[model samples]
Target: TQASYETTSVYGHGHPLYYNNVINCLRGEAEPETDGREGLKSLELLIAMYLSARDGRRVSLPLEY
Candidate 1:
């Protein structure tokens, strides 16, 4: 899993800024810069895709509950 770690590290996928932001937050030098909206969107999309595949229908984004 070294490759996976490297791919997610400060030098890969252009995630350095986000990584540094997290480090700074951990060090109490700054607050977390991300509000997690992007992560929520990604999770929503994944769930929609899973639902669509499971139910054999087109699933919509921002799924209504």
Candidate 2:
């Protein structure tokens, strides 16, 4: 997406921190930031955003999927 960002920020829009966390978790250096349920919530919200944009309507939270 290449949004405006600051390289010094630990939490950038490109999600370097997220990938780092995943790698660290895989190497047993850190715990997973979120479990499946939390991940599901985020996925649902992202899908809802796309649906709302595509259909030109508001999408509700906690999608059925």
Candidate 3:
């Protein structure tokens, strides 16, 4: 379900074709996109899954139940 960014040149700051930014633009949010933050969240989920498997324990969210 990912949007395509292949047409945007690097000098374009990789804008326009990027999915989140487009959605935000349509919504008039005008805030920055979630490019790096999305990757960070994916990494966090991977780490959580790894820790759960290694420790043989259920890994729950630390802040919220």
Candidate 4:
């Protein structure tokens, strides 16, 4: 058995909506709903994944620097 995915957009996914929002922001029509802080956190997590995979060990967030 299987199940359908969940979403709020009529277009099935968020990419197009995200792009449109970016364009609107660039045109000074809308404010960002989110910011680079989250993106930086995500990048940190990705770096942790790479480190753990390379070293074969558990990794922690806000990785020691």
Full-model lDDT for every candidate: 0.81, 0.85, 0.68, 0.88
Give me the candidate number with maximum TM-score: 2
The lDDT, on a scale of 0 to 1, for candidate 4 is 0.88
Task: TM-score each candidate.
Answer: 0.52, 0.69, 0.40, 0.64
- lDDT for each residue of candidate 2 in 1-65, tens digit (9 for 90 to 100): 77765666775555887898999999999999888899888889889999999999999887765
Q: Flag the better candidate by lDDT, 2 or 4.
A: 4
* Candidate 3 Cα lDDT to native: 0.68
Candidate 3 lDDT over residue span 1-65, tens digit each: 99765654664654454666768777998665656777677667878898889999987754132
lDDT of 4 by residue, 1-65 (tens): 88779867766787787789889999999998768997789789999999999999999889998
C-alpha lDDT (0 to 100) for residue 10 of candidate 3? 63
- Higher-ranked by TM-score: 1 or 2: 2
User: Residue 36 CA error for candidate 2 (Å)?
Assistant: 1.9
| Cα distance off (Å), candidate 4, residue 49 | 0.9
Q: In candidate 1, which residue pairs clash?
A: none
Query: Which of candidates 1 and 3 is the stronger one according to lDDT?
Result: 1
lDDT of 3 at 54: 100
Among these predictions, the greatest lDDT belongs to 4
lDDT of 1: 0.81
Clashes of each: 0, 0, 0, 0
